[model samples]
Target: MTITSKGRLTLSVAAFATIAAGACAEPSEELIAAARAEGMLTTIALPHSWCGYGEVIQAFKDKYGIEVNELNPNAGSADELEAVKANRGNTGPQAPDVLDVGLSFGPTAKEQGLLQPYKVSTWDSIPADAKDDEGYWYGDYYGVLGFAVNNDIFPDAPQSFAELKDGQFANSVALQGDPRTGNSVMMAVYAAGIAEGGEPGADALNKGIAFFKELKESGNYVPVNGSAQNIAQGTTPIYFDWDYNLLAMRDKLDGNPPVSVVVPTDAVIAGVYVQAISAHAPHPNAAKLWMEYLYSDEGQLGWLKGYCHPIRFNDMAERGVIPQELLDNLPPAENYARAIFPTLPEQSEAKDAVAANWGSEMGVQ
Candidate 1:
């Protein structure tokens, strides 16, 4: 039983807990009713612009009539983990019920006992490498690294990592954040390392660090947060970020210089973000419902509209569940299918390696 501002009510935690345990019995109707009774779900670190979450949240509201209170929309993966830990046992709107974070962060959150294990109905459809066996976290979608260039500034944008080092893009290359903290920046380094002939392992990031060091010494490598506005204003003409983000920027900033996204032929690195429920979620049932919806056909297609490749994409395509037009709008499917993906251990090791050497090797704080 729990009491809200509206009134006092009784809830069956056992039944809902069973649903979260991925039991053999179906509890969809019960879960829906309970979530509706709660009438709200709180989430953190979901930027409306990233991966079509703006439309996804709206669609969830329209279907369930459950209000979603999104907190710290721009928070990063670390921030999301801290929010859950700090707000544990507090039943309030600020206590996040769900979390979406970098793949490596999922295991960290679980290790810290901040996540709840809950498998959606479509669990079997998700790839084994992308999910936890106990279901504490699962990959929602993935994106490959790319260069988003402002064509107005450089008519011939740097098409490869080799080109970026030729002094042509001096003082123009912008990374989103410190590789020590930002997953995107870290993966940018990973991709660069692979391009520099480093092996596909965590230790190989040293080569990427060396490449960036050379780039910085050559008067390139601007240490500024890259944004669509920054690109439009020519502050950072060459931005390294995810293909989905760069592609979305092209659509978002439609006419101002026009954004062009390119996947460098030398190296392709892919990263995934996973979804999990907070261990102390104030709205557990709603969180479960949200996961269920995300893995559903409608939710997966919603992410596709935002240029993200859903985890179940191939399965849906094989079954012909995805619309033809949506399929047509995506970038070359081979680009994503053929890219290299690091294992969880490798990702964790790489993140730690960058955190240890980013400042000393890259000369950026």
Candidate 2:
């Protein structure tokens, strides 16, 4: 099924509806009652802006009438795991019932017995490779690395990773978080390595470290964590993050200083973020309900509106459920045609390499 510029799919709506009607069942009434009785779900490391989560969360609340207690919106994947560990015995508001973390963190969390398994109703639609057979965790959405530039600060945005090294961007480029712990930051380094012609595994990671080392040495890399406020304030004029994040930030900024999101032409590295229920959840039923909502068509569309490619995008597209406007608003589909999705082992290896070497090798901590 091809997604043309017109945002139309080749699959007939009648054919898809017949298949989808039987496939997409509503959440069970018993589950809804149980979730409502629980009343709330605690979640960690979910930023309102990332993947259009603000809208998604609100929608879930509106639909289920369950309060969502969000914790540490800016925390990274490692932080999310630590939160679960720190609050294992606590059922208070501080405890996180759900986690949305980097793909590599899923298996690690499960191995550590930090996650509980509960497959959503739409689990079959998820690609087999993107989910664990036991349903401990599943890929939610994906996006490629890109640069979000404050146009007011840098009139001519850098179109590629190579361009970021130029002296013209001195003290301007910044990663969204610390590479030592942040998934997106680590992936940014991987993307850089790929752009520098390094092979995809350890070699690319090492080269990526070298690339950042040079950037820091040349005074082009800003040590501060980048955020939407930082971009508007011109503190981190060129921020490295997922394409969806930058696009969402651009929309939120609304031309104030005018943000420009560029998917680097040199290398396009796609990363998937997964969702899981915590093993020690205070509101297990609510957490399950939240997962059910996220995998639903409405929830998937929310992420798409935020510029993320939902994990079940192909399925929805085939079903002709995705809105044409959402498809039209996305960055050129060609930009993602070359996106490289690293394997689980590759991501784990690269993540470990960054965690161990980022501080010593780049001296950026």
Candidate 3:
């Protein structure tokens, strides 16, 4: 979280460019001073184990003296929104300071008036689609939708979505649980649609549904969470895992043979996660300040360590945070050149579509 002096963060769109030039050289002294004056922060993560977040939060606390209280470690996007609605206009002792959520949800949340806007100075560098037009939320780390192949399981691994749909891999592939249940998985549907001609501004996800239908006919998918453990133990052959999970798994295996991550030759879905501040944030100033830091060069670099593609902020890539090895693991910067980020308006429609038609359209609850 950060300090919001008169509802403004330390960094500004005009200053983001200069600040990126020398953030670590001399941290934002002005920003930190503002945070000190504000005094506290609260953060919310839609609860995974927060393996990377653990280190990030510790540093935030140590540097700012703000308690980064992360509530609802296991909640989903829906849960967070409900909290926002329940606590509408109440940035009290129990309200949230910050929120961690999917890219699609950022627009949905902002459109619903559930969020507050803070355009980090790096705002100019960020792609227009990845963040809200009004700065309702800013995407941090994001990944492309891809199929994770286990070299051990398929003698001749599939190379494309079409191959995954081929009958040869019957009962071998795993669905990313239900789109109804997993936000990351849900975005994949939108991404897969891009492969099927669902261009920008298309309201229909029928292409996505068709692809899944073919997979179903192939009997290639098993209902399960993104449990890479299944692959490690040979319980499942392949699943739709992220680049980081596959890379981290390879690192642990001591060799790359057991797993491989791929970016489909067809269009890649732009699945992203974003950060937002509460409209009723008690530490509104602190929350805003935290956003400034989070979007700063120093902050964006933190995700490079987590194996995520940092949102483009003030040409952040020029910095030395990403070494050669990590860059190799990433699907070449060029692959991201064509990636599709969600808009708030598009996301609102998609979320509603998923909720209203997922069961009948995709056999998902």
TM-score of each: 0.90, 0.94, 0.78
Give residue 102's lDDT in candidate 1 (0 to 100).
86
| Cα lDDT computed for each candidate against the true fold | 0.82, 0.88, 0.65
Q: With candidate 3 superimposed using the best TM-score fit, by how many Å does residue 55's alpha carbon deviate from the native?
A: 3.1
Q: Alpha carbon lDDT of residue 248, candidate 2?
A: 87
lDDT of 3: 0.65
Q: Please provide, for model 3 over 25-126, each residue's C-alpha lDDT reduced to its tens digit, 9 standing for 90 to 100.
A: 333678777777767786765332232455567656776787766777656666677777787667565577788787677767787888888877767767
Task: Name every residue pair that clashes in candidate 2.
Answer: none
Model 2: which ten-residue window has the lowest total lDDT? Answer: 1-10
For model 3, the run of ten residues with the poorest summed lDDT: 1-10
lDDT of 3 at 127: 70
Ranking of all predicted structures according to TM-score, beginning with the best and ending with the worst: 2, 1, 3
Off by over 4 Å in 2: 1-23
lDDT of 1: 0.82
Candidate number with the higher TM-score (1 or 2): 2
Clash pairs for candidate 3:
2-285, 2-286, 2-287, 2-289, 2-290, 3-285, 3-286, 4-285, 47-73
Q: For candidate 1, what's the RMSD?
A: 9.5
